[model samples]
Target: MPERPILVFDVNETLLDLDALRPAFDRIFDDPGAMRLWFANLVTYSEALTLSGAYVPFTDIGGAVLRMLAATRDITISDADGAELTERFGSMPPHPEVPAALRRLRDHGFRLFTLTNNTLEVSERQLERAGVIDLFERRFSVETVRRHKPAPEVYQGVAAALEADPGDICMIACHVWDTIGAAAAGWQSALILREGNAPLDVGPQPDYIGQDLDAVADRLIERYGGRGPDRGRTMPPLLD
Candidate 1:
């Protein structure tokens, strides 16, 4: 059997339950659906900033997006409201199956890591709060490259840091744009069909697609488990 590829996970909605922030949104925007809009805009702007050669911290962009959204509806967001959103975002609980699924992947000898748009500090706080921080061997942030996902440079930077061939890495994310970016970088990809996400037809597609982390974990273990030698090896340091 071919050596199993290293698995690199995406944080945010892929592992953590983004819905945990709904209450904050409902209270602040007076519209629960506004959460989705805010998140969508946050992501859109992150990419836009990267494409335009401007970089901003993801959390700052999120805050800016929130204020922008509030302005659109002529609503007011106070300092406390912004703080509450930040707190909720940082403390989002892992999806119901996330912890176990991650453990299972590790048990199957997969080397797990994270590459997120959030800064390393925020991603650490988030995974630590989610109680799954230990599952990852390392967490990478786009801040290191000052670029965001769907930017080939972001994916390439991870591969360069790991000293691994792009083909030896698999990117697992709920966002199709993320998967597409990794695939373009010659990495394998898996897409978890989180709510408001689905497979896209007109692009490089993910190698695996599942309803959630559990389903994706099962598929990975089935495909890559029990190989003759352990291919899921320890990773090198991100910096020399």
Candidate 2:
């Protein structure tokens, strides 16, 4: 079997696309470029919060991004638009290949879960909106871990919750830092190819790097026979 027998996914860019908010952001800022800058700042501050030993819901992060963008661009956005964009984050759509790939992984006897820096409600609602809520057995949020990706504890916590050894868990992410952290923690890595994402050099790099989840799934199946001790393991937290 492939080294990492358990598979955990990073939710946002790795699977879901928050592009639904592009139009929303455009309307607020009167410029499409504003959305990119806003998201960049959102990720920046999130990492800052984790490094500073503080945690905030992704909802707060959304608002913070809006404020940051407005100030930086010298534009004003109405409160209604702010609320709409905040809510828009939850309604992100899963990537085109995600649902099918997730189903294949389940059918092939792989355990699946999500590990995201987004808050629980935000993550859950995103999955539900994408119509793939059944794909992930559990949605793990940093809100509980009080840390974010690239933190050993964030990745380790997922392994702990699933009762899997770090070496036996694979983290699928598009972020180089996330894969680097997982590799450092002994987990297998899969880089779900996405625009503007980078790769890491740790320990021989990711075991699989694919343009999408389906391609990654194919590589995993090829590496590991996919049939396992539990061909029919029960859905985890979702079932509980």
Local distance difference test scores for all models:
0.92, 0.81
Which lDDT tens digits does candidate 2 get at residues 117-210?
A: 8888778888888898887778898777888777788887888888887888888998777788788888989998787665645444887899
Tell me the spans in candidate 1 whose CA falls farther than 4 Å from its real position. 227-240
Flag regions of model 2 displaced more than 4 Å: 1-4, 200-204, 226-240
- Clashes, model 2: 0
Candidate 1 clash pair list: none
Model 1 TM-score?
0.93
Per-model RMSD to reference: 6.5, 5.7
lDDT of 2 at 91: 79
- Return the TM-score for candidate 2, rounded to 2 decimals: 0.87
